[model samples]
Target: MRFLRAAAQALGGGLFLTLFVVFILQVTARFGFNKPLPWTDEAAVVLYVWVILWAAATIVPEREHVVFDLLWNMAPRRVRLGMRIVGNLVVGGLAAVAIPATWDYVHFMQRESTPVLGIPFMWVFLPFVFLMLALVARCAWAVYTALRGQGLEAELHLS
Candidate 1:
């Protein structure tokens, strides 16, 4: 499980770095050389999407996602646990429903190709489906751990 978290973080970070580098190169080429790379914009956009999705998945195990916890914090531990479980179930069900709908949307877009990259647009959009699925899994795991009294400590640190 730790390995999975680390791998997700690495994947997200690496993709984000790649996107930044490509974006900088594109900007330099456009302004400095007066010639822009045709595929750079499309590629950077695709990589950015991947980075955001993977970052969400990577951070989930750390309990870094935002939650309105004022009420939960004030509730008894048992109540909090129940709230967490119910929330996770609701989110998981939503994600499960959304995945197929998103896949259908992606399939609808499959015939369209990105202008510069010439790849099917679905390839770029499909990550949302996977991201949601990952989120559902993470939430379910959190509910499980919480039920077992093994909830992860909050990792939000104030600077």
Candidate 2:
């Protein structure tokens, strides 16, 4: 779990930093040199997508996502437990369904390349695939812990 979280953080942070540097370079090239790289915009967009996806995948695990738990708090203990299981299963199913479809879509685009960089679309879709896999794992873990009467916070080693 620690390794996976670290990997996500590393990948997301690296991509974000790359995006920033690329933007600065883009600006320098366009305004300073008056020669904007056609490939820069697409590259920046790709990097941004990766950063966002990886970062977003950590929300549930980190408990950083905004939650208005008043409704949850109002629920009876048993009902609350049921809700967590149901919610995790539902979300896990969604992620499971998305995986194959995303794979197919990215595969279909394998023959296609970006106009400027000639980078395969499959390469760009890699981060989305990682994100979907992470979601599936995270949701499954959520369901497992909830079913065992142990919440995610416990698994995460929180007090």
Candidate 3:
């Protein structure tokens, strides 16, 4: 688990670094050289998309996610348990249901390519499919942990 966490962090960090480099190149080329490279702009945008989705899918902890938990904090342990299980089931189930269509749409876009780089659209939007799968897996694990009555402590204050 530690290795997996480290790997996810590394991957996210690498993507962010790549995006930063592309942005710097874009700025430098436009202002310093007075000749903007179109590919840098597209690369930066694509990398930005990948970095954000990758972090959300693999790096962000569940506790760090935004939540409206006033009722959860006030609820009894039993109710909280029910809420956790039900909430996870609903989220995980929806993600699972959407996977087929997501895959289909992503696959369908393989015919299209980015204007500057000529990279396939499927490659660009592929992280969304990864995010969807991650959601389903993460929520399923949360549901399992909630069933075991673990990791369900109510926060005293929102972070």
Summed over model 2, clashes come to: 0
The full ranking of all candidates by lDDT, starting with the best, is 3, 2, 1
lDDT comparing candidate 3 with the true structure: 0.93
- Arranged by TM-score, best first: 3, 1, 2
lDDT of 3 by residue, 1-159 (tens): 999999999999999999999999999999999999999999998998999889999999988888998999999899999999999999999999999999999999999999989999999999999999999999999999998999788887636
> Across residues 21-132, which tens digit of lDDT does each residue of candidate 1 receive?
9999999999999999988988998898877776775555444666666676677777777877888888887888788888899888899988987888888777777787
Best by lDDT: 3
Model 2 lDDT per residue over 46-68, tens place? 88877777677763343676665
Clashing pairs in 3: none
Which has the higher lDDT value, candidate number 1 or candidate number 2? 2
CA displacement after TM-score superposition, residue 39 of candidate 1 (Å): 2.1
Candidate 1 local distance difference test against the native: 0.79
User: What TM-score does candidate 3 get on C-alpha atoms?
Assistant: 0.95
- Candidate 2 — what's its lDDT? 0.80
TM-score of each: 0.84, 0.83, 0.95
CA RMSD per model (angstroms):
2.5, 4.0, 1.1
Q: Which of the numbered candidates is closest to the native, going by highest TM-score?
A: 3
Residue-level error in angstroms, candidate 2, position 28: 1.6
